[model samples]
Target: MKDGEGHISIYIELMDTSSLPTGWTVTALVNLFVFDQIRDKYYTVPAQYSFTTDYSLVRFSAVKLEWGITSFVELEVFNDSSNGYLVGDDCVFGADVFLIKQPINKVNVLWMKLYPKGNGKVAGNNISAYLCLDNLTLPSDTNIFVKFSIGVRNVVKSTIIKSTSTGKHHFDYLSPSVGRLHIYPNGNKMKDGEGHISIYIELMDTSSLPIGWTVTALVNLFVFDQIRGKYFTVPDYSAVRFSAVNLEWGITRFVELKVFNDSSNGYLVGDECVFGAEVFIIKQPINKVNVLSLSGEGANHLTRTHIWKIRSFSSLSLDFYESVKFTCGDFKWWIKLYPKGNGEGKGNSISAFLHLDECNLPSDTKVFVKFSIGVQNVVRSDIINSRAEHHFEDLSLGRGFRKLISLNKFEDLKNEILVDDVCIIQADVSIVGIVTTK
Candidate 1:
């Protein structure tokens, strides 16, 4: 009620039943001095947009929804976590934090298969990644590395991306999480498609060159080899312009960053965002990228010791081995023991089946084991039994030592239980089967 300004407020204490309107209507009833007779609650809501809130909110307008400014939205998003997430689809831990910086969430659909069209668009045949909701943006002239996780088959070159836009700033980053960008929405060169991701990056800002700039990012469908072979170079790229821009480090203001899947197979995009280029405030330049180490390295055996003790079973150590430190080529290392359940370690007592596990091992690989051999049980004092056990490699289908001489007995003899005997059989790899002798 202000001085005669028709701007008076109406107070309607409508208890909102916090539920989305599926098929609900609003009925309003009020009485006034102008009305002659007492009126019933009049309900007039034909087609209203449904909205529900989980907090205090006041309606400033009944129809056009003038929700009194509060730190809350009158809506709830029940997202199916299975079918990936869209842009702006976030999980806020503290209720309200989107005011400072743009909050981000990532959803990935790995190993998506697709067939590319030779005409230029990357076919969404096995379209693994989709930004459903309001389409996500892939910046223009953005020199980013977008990698797909494809396997030893499937042509990423013939692939293209098809998506609706959010009207503005709709760019795509296939494998780019780092560097320089020049391609814009209207540019038409770096639009989201298949065969290869094409974009440009900014190298020179103002008059100074980017001294600390280098492109580095982990991409999907791209292995170390594929990256080495393709994408790293955009043909004849010199400046950020129409078709393909040349990308060398400091020569041009804009450079094109390209990525192509050498082995058209399925690959999972790892969720670690690397920079298009890491800029350092340096006077001159720094170092080149780090050199690669051991290629396709198998396991480097750590504690290669055999089990030789009370025979019934020796508890395997679980503390020392949390994860497998060595690689097992084609076969897995399954360190077994006797008495079925004696490997059960308890506290410090050797009783638990302590082990490290690996799931992504290659097929047809096996592990050889060695034992801790000490003097006491056998005819030779310098040696316990046999360094004497025999073993051979086999091309069998299953894992473990192809040809091995396992102790084959939980207790070889009654007195063989070594209450007084002191011995330790040392071997190379952890034997799959526990070998014991009297």
Candidate 2:
């Protein structure tokens, strides 16, 4: 049949309905098709419908035995020569019917949660809801399209407090996690003043966790130095506890904005910077105490200075050179220098490290020291130095700065760091404290 709007429809009509049983009804899956001349295929439209007698038509001595699509195809499309529906004034139309005694059923499951106290930035002021898909039950590469609605009812008012329908969303393996890093380039006013950047690691929906649950972890934040290819690490000396009341922990003044934005610093290059975090959860912390005794005030606390002079410094070609062992505190130490820098600072700066000789000390002993290492400019009496405090043990034998001094400044004739092919490096060591577990 053809409609007034120039659309043709197909219908299935049962003949001789008088032979059917009383109050008869049948359901069928139907497909209407048109022949494609060029492709030699059929363009089919499939649908399901139940056919029953129409009592109104029965009163007029007729039976309503027709049920099918009302808009199968437009007349213009069916007659178009390019569509291959009609070729040389000849076309074919047909239908296929699959009778079904019972309909098949399928079920899809999804998990959802509602937070009356809100979550994330909207916590304590608004309500939020989230839907989760069960990935464990599905194939690894499966993708799901979802549309859902969430509503909260006000029982006292007999009305909906809020109702919202989020249209369609695609879910995949790369979905966002509940923990995120919050960075404020201009600094967080509540935590820090201006001229600095603030960073925090936050657990988004802490209210969803089990009661009295707490997580203790050692967190370290880092800013990448693009030019040096290394990270400036800011480590937390102690473990931080995260709970429902306390959702985040971080540095209020991570880095001064001026220092981070400076091009020479290699931090904010090309208007981009990288920030990351390392969180090590302490699953079973040991219950132990450490007592430290420093040796820098009394007779035994005298500072020790070691000056190592290298002849033919310009002729040294090794990647690294180590000074002879020197006495510091109760342990022996040495100075390790990379003439052309090392690791991330290779070819750009001079790298120096203080190494502890752990062979003589007890296997479990840890030594804490504060030391300064420098290259002396003999002509101007100006020293380029780097100072740090570190704990040295069997596992951690060395620690120092990679970019100690730029090669340009270190080798400049005016700096006189290297004079007449001779260079001198000095180290000042002091025993800060020692950590020994009982």
Candidate 3:
């Protein structure tokens, strides 16, 4: 059969399992195959299982008598011409089963311990638990991938106290343990000691990492405003270094308690709030140092201007248009215009934006730019304009006004901003500084 993800499935079906003996059982190693015409060979997937009448194996039963591979081969690989699994619109599939004698039963048990009073770094503040495996029962080199769940039960009410599951993890000779720690008594710790909101990013299990490992990253934290439908973001302009000794970085007082709790602010609604973070890891070259050069702020600053002339402006029906790329401050930039405006200005005004070509900039590079976007008046010296300054990086590649000018004012006959169905857009860009890792 074919599965939903376009993969072939194979199953072993048993007939009349109720007529078998009480302890009847058969163990076998099975292999499913797909014939490759080009190679004149078979692609095989192997698995081992035991079909039994006994109740020990929970997965096998009289009612459920079939078991096998669900993903035998991908449809794409089976149908590709070059691979030749299918030729002349015909394909071959088969299975092989080898009977095996019953093997000795072995049981591996995992031990878990809970500290009701908490432990280690979380003492007195939270509860903790650890999972342990008896390495002496297995070979020294043996490794197992395991996933399990832990829960605290309420004995009096016969209900759940708290429960969490550990995602898959590898257990080996060196690192044979994995567990959870510092589960707060009440709930998640969204607030700091001062009653204000707090947030941070921490590297998990840093003790297991190799020595001398370090990571440098730029971090941005955000809180969602339910009323505004936008994020209130705080960003770190510079990168923060994280190592074994310093595993976390963030803001303790992300927002004042009074401000965030206010109903009008829309930060917390229905006793729920959303918080998120963006961390960009900066990779550095081994055995080399990075030097950042900054351009002077005042007299030594560099500036440039570009004018875009849009002919047949009324004929533009698209949502937005991009001007030809121009160079400034050793970087490429382009002007973006929305004929019918966008976002808040849609259908009522004209929108304009300046964007940096982030693809050409290094991952660790950031450019601080001050710029002005305007529409030139053909009949008068006055130009409708707006100015802003921003630090351009991967996350923020563009900045501009959503309502550059009201459509009524821009189209007024006396303004002459648009004459002969041609309009002019101008941008004055100045580079304040630049930071880059060499």
lDDT of 3 by residue, 259-358 (tens): 8878789877887666655443433345443444445554343687899999998799899999999988678999999989988788998999999998
| Residue 6 C-alpha lDDT in model 2 | 76
List model 1 lDDT by residue over 374-403, tens digit each: 223343333333231212133222222211
Give the alpha-carbon lDDT of every model. Answer: 0.26, 0.66, 0.65
lDDT of 3: 0.65
Using TM-score as the yardstick, the better of models 1 and 3 is: 3
Candidate 3 ranges with C-alpha deviation above 4 Å = 1-301, 413-415
lDDT of 2 by residue, 1-438 (tens): 245367777666756767767767654434567778556588865321101111011111134567656687889998889998875455668776544332222224567766789776867997877665554554443445554555677899998743322223333332212244667889999864478888777655444446777755445567779899987755332245677777687777788999998989988889767776654333433435575776544736436888989878878899999999988766788999998998778999888888988776776678777789988889888777888766677867887767888888876653376677778889988886777764
- Predicted structure 3, TM vs. truth: 0.36
If scored against the real structure, what TM-score would every candidate get? Answer: 0.20, 0.35, 0.36
lDDT over C-alpha atoms for residue 199 of model 1: 33
Off by over 4 Å in 1: 1-199, 202-338, 341-377, 380-438
Per-prediction RMSD in angstroms? Answer: 27.8, 32.4, 23.7
